[model samples]
Target chain A: MRRILRKHAIVEDDWTLDDAARTPAGLIVPLARWRAERELLLASAAAIGVLLPNTEDVEAIYPQIADRPLIALQFPTFTDGRALTQAVLLRNRLGFAGELRALGDVVRDLVFWLGRCGFDAIVPRPDQDLEACRGALDELSVAYQPAADAHAAVWARRRMRASA
Target chain B: MYRYDEIDRELLKQRTAQFRDQTRRFLAGELSEEDFRQLRLRNGLYQQRHAPMLRISVPYGLLNSAQLRRMAHVVRKYDKGYGHFTTRQNIQLNWPQLAEVPDLLAELAEVQLHGIQACGNDTRNITCDYLAGVAGDELVDPRPYCELLRQFIALHPEFYWLPRKFKFGFTGATIDRAATRTNDAAVHVLRRDGAVGYRFFVGGGLGRLPLLGQEMNAFVPEADLLLYACAILRTFNRFGRRDNIHKARIKIVLREWGVERFRAAIEEEYAKIGASAEGGQLKLLPEDIGRMRGHFDAPPYRPAGEAAADLRAQAASDPRFAAWLKRNVRPHKSAGYRVVFVSLKAPEQAPGDCTAGQFEALAELCDAYSFGELRSTYDQNLVLADVAERDLYALWGRLDAVKLATPNIGLTTDIIACPGLDFCGLANAGTIGVTHDIYRRFDSLEAQYEVGPIRITMSGCMNGCGHHSVGHIGILGVDKHGEEWYQVTLGGSAGNDAAIGERVGRALSRSEIAGGVERLIRAYLELRSDEEETFIECYRRVGMEPFKARLYEAEGESGKPVPSESEERPPGESGQGARAGMARRGVAAA
Candidate 1:
């Protein structure tokens, strides 16, 4: 039987019965509402996951839920990629060792910045191509600065050499 | 000024590269004009009336001699010879080609400076009291905190695109010299229980609508500063109005939600963020703050007796020299050392005007005499922070030779006029011309100081960029009959007790402007209880009625005052003053 996650709907092969049961029941967290439910969601498995209301919402909440089992960042639109970038910062800066995911109407082009920020998995709409979307991550080998996902401090390395 | 770490330099370089690519793509028709407009604005390039102007962040108006020299080089190489120091403590270059802006940014990166977020709808350069670390009454040095905020907010993923521009100002001094009441969010460093923290105020702003910030947090512990600021930014991002660009600022959110509701929202958000420890750890530790304070070490000073003796001798010998010394020099906390304010408001020159060569010369002087540091004040004056008493004459001579010294620091001619219609498209009237008129009127430094200390500020319009609202004798340019008229206000101040100047009466014709100002000063001199009381104190004591009566006395017969006889008609308004007998003697009128 094939099941789908209602929020992002990225169909996974290794989902258990419990995962499937919880997938359909997702809550839409407005920016303010997310702040109120942050601690509660961090401790609860029943909540499934929360949606980012805006860019600032993700930035404010990212450090707190970096280690959570499942987290989804919502982008209101593709043009303003601030929230998606914030999700990456959570994974990168704060070392948010958790399942990083992207939801909402995220465009294919933005997948690069999102991946750079730290999103390992992206769940675009059912109409989008999953295979092509995955290829977006492999487009760029070198980024000028060390972003959320990248472990190497490229700027720091340059500075060390200049001083040496 | 703090030197940038490797991280700062790297970030600036990367940012320049990113902007270069963005600009290239835009030029190649890969991005729409609207998209490019936002992108360019984020990088501090603005499409102004004449050209693309770039506003470079000075970061609390603090610069060492080396940084200033570097900026001078940039200005000379990439832009016009001069730069405009803005009210928010940023420097604006009026003439930089749009195509060359990316290159300019690259050059600035080499100096560890960039125009990032200088004009964007994001957090702008954080301003603080120009005397932050040096002020005698400063409880804590606000530079480190300002620096921390600068780093955190720069390219912050969340706040890069807020509903409107956000401004934050910090002041460590007991006196509110940073104009905290006019910023979007202001942090006042205060001492609590022998520990340092901040008293946070939010929603304050000036412009079309002037509002004082309400105290959001009574006391924010040092550790939770960034977290709480983030919480506030998050709340504002979510709740601030996006429908109207004019009303979308955080100030509007505070107005709609009320301070109580707004504070509650931030507190609620703070609670959800959980233990402030994680965010607190990012803040400068107490020891780090102390270490930073050590960088701003005070220079050595001799005893005060020798300095006083030298000043007395100068006064006895030269009246002009004495008056200049009295009005322009300020006593430093250290004895035998003084803070010399280099007045930029010279006759016919733009306020804060300094050529590239002049900037270099000033930097050289600072390196030699002072401790290699130069501070740009809110009032558009530059400070040689550590001038020795013995070197005063030599320093003054060099400054005068360069035409950098005007001998009018806080007097009538030391006017804080905005770039008005000359460079800024937002202005309605020309402020630089009005400043010229005032400078010509108070040409004699002796006469100006004799009349006593006065602050004459002019703003082109009601936006108050020149801080006209707080000037002791504030002149605002008003447009009437397709000609520029001057509206004068009195008793405004911006010290511990700040009050907006009250309108004295009717606006003056451009020609009668200088005479009208002269009459107002004469009235102030006559009405003052004592010579010691400044114009503001006297105005406060007697009110505007006496000044108004004196100003409008000549027009008593016609019920409309004819322009003063000793007034020079505005450039084009000569026909209106045909009947005046004194019109022929335009020398006195000017």
Candidate 2:
């Protein structure tokens, strides 16, 4: 069982990514598999999730967001940051309100950026300390740019304060 | 210059602390080397050949006297007694210790300076025309927009990592003094119809394949500039190639997809970003623009037109001052004021290096003369952007005492050379030795003046940081079986008419480069239609055959190897310098 940092807390992950699970319930299948068995999986789903590769266009899943419980965007490697854009597009553009998870090559150092890009759940690499990752999330309270995060950009805040 | 408010200071404090922790983790072996490199590079730390080099971002190349004093103090107290001003308008300290970098960054932050995004895959420290607000032919002042863009890109979460490093250059004047066409993106401020807007050129770069930017958008309204930039960035982040480092820059992406397809993708992304609630908030409100403009308001200028008679008298008394006045000064936007270029291309020193003592003196001079402000040009020189005509003599006297007043700006002796093999870890050959040899050949100011205005840019390696591709005379160093060789290119220009220089002939040996350059200049002098016809113009008119003939024919007369087709550059050793051999060459050079 793997523990993931979900919304700033390290908790045991209930969602399994194994394709050949004895029961398809709570199984997060790859994008291709989910697309192939879409009708079958939608009927008896106990909480279906889709493991979307970073390369997959988020536009394809815009209509499917309402049904999916989770969408895990793959990082492949920490430096390969195409997933950051995917996560942003999913949360900000497609309006996916479900659990937007980040998987693969996740480190405590990258926890802040992952959260800012709307990754609620992060599967940190085995060596990363969960406590350190939790602390890293709040390392920078000020952001200069607007992202999918809840905080307003500093300029906007400044404008509001000045008007007030 | 934009001063940091409490929010900006807090952000910098937090970012510095984060780097401190990352350094601790790396030192403690908690972070892997490859992982630590990604973290450190964002904070402007690089592991060079001799020591860790820290590049401090002087946003838009604007700095106050106090900030310069702090830089002087930091350089003197840190590993080195000097620093190098890069062509991108950032200052690089080459010998800082890795463990002490966090403290160095902290000191810099006290003066509202930080290394954030200075040399990373993120939007790099923005470069702008050194004469942004002061140039006489200016349209809209670009400093405020540059500041806004600088803040928006600093530590942006989504763009923290991309396929490759990105750069930006901005210009507000009629002339492109910032070399905007050679950057990742160029933002030109202009007025269309009745309102101010920006013309964006994207996919420009100077690397393995040098390419100028294409006009991505003709007119982006002032309010939507940042949003448009975000769209461009998001598209690049999503689609830029990661498999090959050489093919990862936006230029390659734009080339592969074609400008039309790339423009379509950016436009689509722009529409989506503008529609999104989160991104709509990122729009530049009029209030926000006003706030930025307030910071960069012009300094209080006083008219001194009456000083013209005194200036003429001084010039008449001293021919040296007259030559300097002709070469090193430019007409200011304000009446009775001038823009003074303090040349760092002294023959005895490295092209862009300034010692700690010189920095301190320059700081004092800034307080006395240019409204306590200084700007670093992309040509690796400093500028006193708002000096009064009455104070010219006094300022020149102080500058001359410090050996900072070289009167060869854009002339033959005013060469731009990178640190090459001596300092840069990536250089294949030495640049300073050959630069000194050329300086000795053109030793006198009179001799240099004979050649007229020509840009001779040299790079140690093919990374093109010296901007060799755009120089009127480009010198590229290549490694030949443990020996150093130089390749020459002619007729490159980096202004509004940007073009990549064409190769002249085969590579010149280390012993042959200086004389070869002299012969090329001699050919230009002899072949020019008139003295008024500049080197680039004459070269353009006469073409390369005559110059190539002069170089090779002269080489044959000297009993050296003559240029020939059989001696062409190796399959992989073209001036682009294949990226495959980078790692091996780096290790071998070290």
Candidate 3:
């Protein structure tokens, strides 16, 4: 069984993704099917999400699925960081506040950076341990450059505490 | 010398643990070789030709006596008893076992020294004018900004896998002592309208394609420096070529896209990045500057006192000390202080290679005479930045005794050469042997003193580690039919007018380098109009033709690069050269 890490803990994955023949709901579709059968998926009552490839033209896809329940960003390889850019845009530029899940090649090493880049859920590759991923988040107590995370940089934090 | 706070200390400790774990995983056969290589590179560990070479960063070339002693102990205990100082103002141990690097890194963390961001595709140790704080002509000390950049970029997640490694340097002084323009991005700190800002220059590089950095912004407010730098790197990371390693550096991207387009992209990225919520976090707070300046404040100095008069009398009375004084000593910003340069190019050892014994003595001297701090100059010599004028005589005696006082600072014999074939895996030719040969030719202090200031730089290959491209007389080692051939370039300068040296003619053989250098120096001495005219001044006044003519056509006969038969096999049926085709890593044709 696949486990999803949400809010720094293992959580049950609710959303079902079926690519072959779309069942009677709860199916996240690829870009082609989502565009081709857009009216059917949109009108359906079951909650659905879209899986975005690392190379997705996020700007073009943004207008189409502005109100999707969730977005699953795929990392083709851990080293390929295009999805991180897409995630940053999704969170800040497009105001994506709903579920943002990272899947495929989500190794333990990339978990901390992925969290900083606005991913709320991670589905790590088979080789990566879920508990190890949790530990990666607490590795560094300080970050000089602020990521998309809510916390201010350590420098700012240090200044605030000093004044307080 | 930004001292680490509790937060900063935690970050380093965490990073060391992470690297240690990764190294452990790799050694246990869990991680792949290629994966381990990329991971190890960011920590400055390289599987070199002979053994693993670890480059330890000396941030802006600043080190205290205790840190120096620690390095001395580490190197002596680990692999070799010495380390090679690099052009980037870092130190490289030529031999270390791969398995021991993790333990070594843990040890280095104790002294606040590690290989973090010293190599690989990240911002190189932010370099600056070695005389930054102490220089008389400095507008503002660039160290605070350098340290700021250093902290901001170390283990920065976004820049972990840039298309190529990026180098950043800055200088507040009017003269470009740090070779600021050769870096991928540089800041020339200036105070305009009573506000300190920086002039950002981009795309200037030396290597396979060398071009002077173009000024991107005349003045960027100090608050936005880090944000702007981040935007530049992000832009490069997105658009730079990852397919071809040869054309991977930001310079190539900037060149191919043209400066106007590249500038537009960067500005767009900058504005986007600025608009983001995270942007404000990286901005420099006023307290940050105040905090850093406290650490770098000048040590307590005594009044120049009777020492100035005593030194003057000593200079007049003693010719040897006078030569040493005239060459090695320079004025320090503080009263009663003088900067003394200790040349690493001693009699026998390679240029910039200092042994453990040397560091031990130097550390003791620094603690006694100076303020227990030693700064490494970009020219590969060490500096006693805050040496008192009173102790100048005593320090010189000690230095001369150790063979460190060569009296060749900024003179003809003070040569800088990279460890070409002798140590570096990327080198196609030898550098130390040539520097030693040339140094001995101009051995006499009287002869070298009379010849005057001439900058000679040599690189084993196009990877201009020796910074050969900017030398007043640059020598690049090219492999000709598996044999070493030295190519000479006459008019390079790393000063305000930074220009890459142009080749004089065809390349010369290994044996011909020292003789060729002597002839060029002789030509300069003869052609110079006055005694005040330096070699560069004379070369600039009279173009490369005169010097080229003298070296090539002694009696008006075209003679260099005589068509010779090659004993080494020319090429295979594939038409590839005898030597393997290797990508030039910067030596960004400065």
Write the residue-wise lDDT of candidate 1 on A50-88 in tens digits: 445544555556665544455667766554545643564
How do all the candidates rank in terms of DockQ, highest first?
A: 2, 3, 1
Candidate 3 chain B, run of 10 with poorest lDDT: B569-578
Q: Write the per-residue lDDT of candidate 2 for residues B45-75, one digit (tens) a residue.
A: 9877567889899898988999889988999
User: What's the lDDT for candidate 3?
Assistant: 0.80
Using lDDT as the yardstick, the better of models 1 and 2 is 2
Candidate 2 on A18-96: residue-level lDDT in tens? 5565564477888888879888877754578988878878886667655688988888788888999998888888888
Ranking by lDDT: 2, 3, 1
Candidate achieving the largest lDDT: 2
- Give the alpha carbon lDDT tens digit for every residue of B279-320 in model 1: 433444555555445555555555677554477787778766
**Residue B486 C-alpha lDDT in model 1:** 74
Q: Which CAPRI level is candidate 2?
A: high
On lDDT, the stronger of 1 and 3 is 3
* Clash count in backbone of candidate 1: 2
The weakest ten consecutive residues by lDDT in model 1 chain A span A13-22
Per-prediction backbone clash count: 2, 0, 8
Q: How well is each residue in B1-590 modelled by candidate 3, as lDDT tens digits?
A: 67778777877888888899989989898877877787788899986656778999999889888888888888898868998888888888987788888888888888889998777776788888989888999998888888878877877766766768889889999989888898899899889998988999988777656667788888888888788898888777677776776688888988899999999988887787678765766677889777777778877787767435468899898888998898999999887789999998887678898888888888999999888998887788999988888888889999988889988899877888887765666676777778888988999887887788889999887768788889999998776655667789988987798889988987777678888899999899999998889999999999999898766644223344453534322211111121332222222110
Please state the error at residue B330 of candidate 2 in Å: 0.9
